[model samples]
Target chain A: MIEPGSFRDPTSRVFYDAGRVFRGLSHEAAEVDAEVRSSGLMNDLVSRGLFVDNWIVNDVTPPSGVSSVSVIESERVPLVTYPAEWPFSILKDAALATLDANLISLERGFILKDASAFNAVLRGVTPVIIDVTSIERFGERGIWTAYGQFCDHFLAPLMLEAYAGIPIHRTLRSRTDGFPIGDLGRLLRGRSGFRKGVLSHVRIRNFFENRAAGMETSERRDVGKATLARPAIVASIQKMRGLVGSLESCAPSTWADYESALPYEESSIDEKDRFVSEAAVKAGAKGLAVDVGANVGRFTGILAEHFDLVVGMDNDPGAADGLYDTVRRSDFTNVTPLVVDMTNPTEAFGWRGKERAALSDRLHPDFATWLAVVHHLCLGIGIPLDEVVEQIFDFCGESVVEFVAADDPMAQRISATRSTDLAPYGVEEFEEYVARRGVVLNKKPVSDTRTLYHLKGR
Target chain B: MTDPLFAYIDPGAGATLAQLALAGTAGLAAIGKLRMNKIKNRLTGKVSVDSESEPDVPSDESAATE
Candidate 1:
């Protein structure tokens, strides 16, 4: 019996048991896989180690196409990640790898049928292309079926990071399927924007996209090349790579707010870091977490030890930039940073339909750190304490959070510009709020105005 | 006799944890539980607990209190 799964790629179905894996395909899909294999694309990818464990020959004849297609039994990989979880550098690397894969696919007589970032998943620092089904033979009139997808998945996000000084963090968490066209288009179409390729690649698609909004339900599909001339596809892919780089090199971070604001004073920062490290170890959390107002990831960096993983999430590019820069400079295996607007967090969404992984879903029962974060969400962002508790309890098992006073200078700065709809942040109120939701550990005073509360879900 | 293991791979960060101890005599069943629950949750998006963070007793502190 086969337990079929994986919804992103409609054509291929993944199955596994006893350390073995199988891929079920309809007759046509198997034929396509065979074509990809016989055409030598599979061998090329295997040779380059671009793929994870590979297809093992099998005899489960599928029921589509000209003839029955047999299942391609394969080895099961240990992990499957979506783009939303990746830090900026990892996403960039995935895009570069995808471009490289496209180039390689052309060399091996195939084209990446879908250059969507979802085709890749990270295993540590290495970015491996996971979706074998997203390939087809190269042809002269090859349409970038994944073109619109790539724009949403890779190009748009990259450009946002490059030009607008927004880290692609929101794109990752909010758009696991791919960044929504409307949002990316809005970002790219900002006032005085649409410079060069942005107009061509993004605006053009946005036009067709708005046009295609609801005219047709969908259309019948096929397995073969949309077009099969090698030269044209290769040229287009090359142009795409150039465009991607320009998107990457658009502009670096230039936010004065980041320059002016201090995430943490030197002494407070170090002590906070040490405190987090000790807590994460004590909690036996497989991972440590920092809410994005994470500033520079100092707490996450310090807690990176002892815990198997550390996640630094912050909404600001200037802040995420610092986090990403640290991850890039170090060999810290466990640390990751994401862009999160905590006031409106990214919700869980699926690959195909609603029956897949959401942004917050995870296999690990976790331990987390929400340091220096609640105040920004509370005083600055206007999220309620109860909702904050709910978000944490949903994602983590045990968590530690900092309750910064409304009068704190840092709190004042974060809220000075924004409308603080919520009442002023208070330690007593926060303690009571936490207690109602779960068992609140004793408070550890990080400062007169800033204190950390350890928590366990009741 | 056979053994199994528990692996939690966070999709966003790609930070995964594998508990080798979960494969031993003490953990063999725990491994089975992990695998079982993982499959259930993977195919079906079920957050193990809802109202998980809801306070045991209602709190006066809220958005108004911040």
Candidate 2:
């Protein structure tokens, strides 16, 4: 069964059961029902290849007391994917889909009552509008009726990623409803500088946003009954999309600085890849595989050899994007990349309640890998080795994790910070901590310092 | 190959759009009625999705287990 996403707008969210999809629209949105029908928008869109997202008057009635106002129903989608799992191009398409949906709604004599990235979802690689009932009539609209919302969701995140090379939306884990304009403005402050469009859309606008911090929740503010005079609204969204397309990361990273600092010899890197791949095939894992600290998914590709699907999780935005690009370009549909610090994994989507959803609440992988990642977690991130063991056991049944002994070049470099506390961290301590939780059967020394533990649950 | 388009793009929106247009026009027929009590009509029949009424929603315990 498909679970409902956190799309809790006042309007109805579509639900699909068995084989049919349904949306539940209330009287508020149904006010323009007649006008919408007369405008032939539904018909026009149907003819122009719009999906049958919302159903017409169907067999299932809107519960007993929904008579005074109409509660129209619509079709539901099969599955819902969160924005965090989406690739760069997928987000771009969602942005375009939202703008397109808004334009289409105007042509049919209706205006989008609300706009949020959550309103769109990915079907295959395309973004589709999930809530058709969100459209409502409010008389003639202005040139940019949806300008503010577009700014909040699509435009803001896209601009930040393009110009600053930072996936700003990842910050949503802290502040929901996309990024708060205030925080985004603050994040932009320390940034080096910006291009022209960034100046108009974010930098300058932020000065004005700072003027009114807690005046009112942006969602609840009264936008008035101004309709987006169809053309104006469509033109507005289109212009925003065009504006988005114009922004681009100027060039790749300065390869000289990072690339030249080659810590590992080519043979050593190859040996690590071969070691992870060999262990996974030996383990006979068949379902999902997860790679912790999957920088650019190098080991994810290796571990992927033993599973149907692989998830490469990393905290760095650049790492996730790089991994996603590699997977996409290679047509490796089996791999899914996400931005998540192992120390601060997504506890939950926070839909029903803010319970700490065990990491497996979303994915249940059979096997896992931790190649060259343990050092970052133990020494760099400061998560206790014991808790790290528990988190790993929570997600995988059997796994191969490489422990970068404190003396390993990487670990030593990570802990080079004089302030770090690595007194309680060591391969012996990790082995003992994980052994109490699971069977640490073998400790095969991969090198003079690091050791690979073959772990299995009780 | 993954579709170059975003995954959420619906294949059946055309049919739904047609039905919405038809229903929209039907509702417009009562525009005069809508105006006289539009405010009241708009707020009417809002389904307050209270926890008790949300039967399909699963509890945390239920979600964790199979």
Candidate 3:
């Protein structure tokens, strides 16, 4: 079946057949592919681990109506995440990687036709460009055509995060095409409007965009003739890289230091780790394992040892960013960190809400660790214990859930902020919900107020 | 097979035109900076080769057309 998201580009179409991913290129796209391959650029990108590994497959039959076809098979990304689900640092890194890829392509007499953030997928902490067909020969149009897209898809959102303290991940959820330049321009119209990149990248670009929009087709074509020298184009891209590199997320740090300030005793932390590890091993952790509420990835590190692939998810941008930094620094090749709130996860969106699959549909982990997360969903978010249990079972077959009693310091701290009484939140209520939805294989008391349960979905 | 261009996403005409203008400005600024550095080196009695003075290599403009 043709990949729903791969229909926009007519020259190439991505399809899956019998668990294998394939890209069927038209005769025209094949010629471009041959040129790029012959130029040795593809091998260079693949060797550097910057591009997805794909090889020509001659055995696969082409789809009907095409005169001829060149089929390429690709290594599928374990989990496909959109830019909206990434933390600030992850998105920043992806933007830099895209620019680097484009710069490298320019050196090889080619350029990326589109600068869409969707073209890149995070494998572990590294972002790899998956849209091989986006590369094409650098045409005589001496200006980079995808400049507007880069500004829209990367620069605008990043600037908002850096300047206005707005989290791009949340903003990007609805604006898949990246933030509109005009809207960004108006939003940053105060002091931030005069910030370094804001004036040129957002305001000036938006002005030109509006002007071009109002022009006649003939007038616009005349303006399109405006060109620059190759060196100048390269310099502009380099300047963009410098500007993007300088941006730092100004979003207030939350849960970034959660591990440092544990509400429970230090021994309890180690005890919880042991319990989670034992549960994972008992469940035969070989497939994907997710560390939900993985603030700074204390338990994600443990799951990484047993599972083939581990995903560390946290709603806090700072926590997810911290996890990404730790994973990259430690060179953990199997863990993918995501910024996701369990209570309000990413929903299905895009063309007919079918182009991009929702988070729950994509993640079917063999094992999951919901350490210190249930109380936040139930007491903090006011979600019922049964509903939280059902959501957990929906994502994984088996999980290690940590139950924090309402009297616990952290739970009290969460409940104190709410006007609603959470006095009924106790061990009995949790176990009843678990019994209704699944079976608890084992239980261990990590602390006076916290207990770990190894649960299997019915 | 005949169509050489497959630019599916519309590269905004205004943005493209603005990029050309911006690149030109950036190029001029770089040249100015290079000239100032060259002058500074001369005053400081540091002999340095001015690579910017070299002739430009001809580019392959005919390689591909949109």
Candidate 4:
């Protein structure tokens, strides 16, 4: 089937046949593809792991009615995630990778025509550009056409996080096209609007944009006549690199220190680990495993040892960023960290909501660890226990769920803020709901107030 | 045939102008250097390399208009 998200680029379309990913290029795009390949740039980028690995499929037929003169097959990414599901570091790394690829392409007499963050996919910890068709022969126009997009998609969001201390994932969820500069200008109007990169890329650009909006068509066209040399263009991108590289998230993570502050004794913590490991063994050591509330990835690291690929997911941006740092520092090639709020998980977005698949639809894990997350989903978010059990089971074949009693210190702390009585948040009621939806294979108590159940959906 | 240099997203005219403006004095220096090279080449009866090699393609904004 034709990939719905691939429709924006008319010259090329992505389609999946059987299990492999393929791209059908139009006659013009095919010519450009041939040039890209012949120039040796494709091989160079692929070898560097900066671009997705793909090869020409000579004998294969293009999908029906999809215009193509040539077909190429690409290595499919294990899981596809959007910017809204990425932490600050992940987004920053993606932005750097995009710039690296663009700069390298420019050296080879080619350029990335667009700099959308969607073009870059996180392959484990590494960001690789998957949209090969975005690379095209550099025209005589020396100005980088993708500069505005780069700023809108990468710079603006990063600035918001770095300067305004705002988490951008939720904002990106709504503004799929990236934040508008006009709105960004007003949002960062005070001291932040005058910051180094923000001053030039945001404030000045906003001024020129507003001015251009008021100009006549002919006068607007005259603005395009102003050009820069290739060296000057390179300098501009290098400047962006310096600014983007220096940006760091200033927002504090709520759950970054959750594990440290846990009220559990050392023995209880060790017992919880032992239970999770035993559950992982029972689930079998293969395929994908997702740690639903993998804050700082303590259990995610253990799951990574058994499963071929482990996706560490957490709602807290700081915690997710910490998990990403762990993955990079330890060189865990099989672990992918994502910022996902289990309550309001990433939904099907883009055109008709079919362009990008929902997060749950994309992950089909063999096993899952829903530890320390149930209480938050239940008492914190007010999602019923039955609904929570069903939603957790929906993502994996089997899972180990930790039930934190309402009277537990953490649960009470969570419940203290709310006025509603959480009477049904007992171990007995949770087991009943779990048994209703699926079978409980084994049950182990970590402490007087917390218990772990190995469960499989019917 | 469709223009092969088509940009999927419209690179705003304001952005293009803004980039030039951001280039500031350095951009002016580069333009000046190119003009000087052309003048020097003419004085020495040498062919200008950039003039010969530059492709006759429309800028991104101009192409968007088309």
Residue-level lDDT of model 3, residues A1-458, one tens digit each, is: 77888877888888878878888898888998998899999888888888999889998865563324789888888888889888888889989988888888888778887899999888867889899878887743355768999998999899998988888877798556899888888788678888888877876677667655544343344444445566677788999999999999888878999888888788888888899889989999798999999999989999999998899999988888889989989958898888887777888888888888888888889999999999988888898877787787888889999999888999889889796654357799889878887999999998889999999989
**lDDT (C-alpha, whole model) for all candidates:** 0.57, 0.56, 0.80, 0.81
Model 1 misplaced stretches (Cα beyond 4 Å): A1-10, A15-22, A31-50, A55-91, A125-127, A139-145, A160-228, A249-265, A285-292, A349-356, A362-365, A416-425, A437-443, B1-66
lDDT of 3 at A152: 86
Give candidate 3 regions above 4 Å deviation: A62-68, A139-141, A420-424, B1-4, B25-66
* lDDT for each residue of candidate 2 in A356-423, tens digit (9 for 90 to 100): 23344666778888877777777877777887888778878888888878877767887898465454
lDDT of 4 by residue, A298-393 (tens): 999999989988999999999999999988999588988899888887788888878788887887889999998999888888888878887877
For each candidate in turn, the TM-score is: 0.67, 0.65, 0.89, 0.90
Off by over 4 Å in 4: A139-141, B1-4, B26-66
For candidate 1 chain A, which ten residues in a row score worst on lDDT? A216-225
- Ranked by TM-score, the better of candidates 1 and 4 is 4
Q: How far is A360's C-alpha from truth in model 1 (Å)?
A: 2.5
**Regions more than 4 Å wrong, model 2:** A1-7, A14-93, A100-113, A120-145, A161-170, A182-194, A198-223, A249-268, A278-285, A303-306, A348-360, A419-423, A440-444, B1-66
CAPRI verdict (incorrect, acceptable, medium, high) for model 4: incorrect
- Residues A10-129, candidate 1: write the lDDT tens digits: 456665545566666655566667877887778787667576557746555533321234566544443445565555566777787787777887776666756667667655345678
Candidate 3's displacement at residue A27, Å, is: 1.1
Looking at model 4, residue A155 earns an lDDT score of: 90
lDDT by residue (B1-66, candidate 2, tens digit) is: 111111122211111111112223332232223222212222233323442264234452363242
Candidate 3's docking class is incorrect
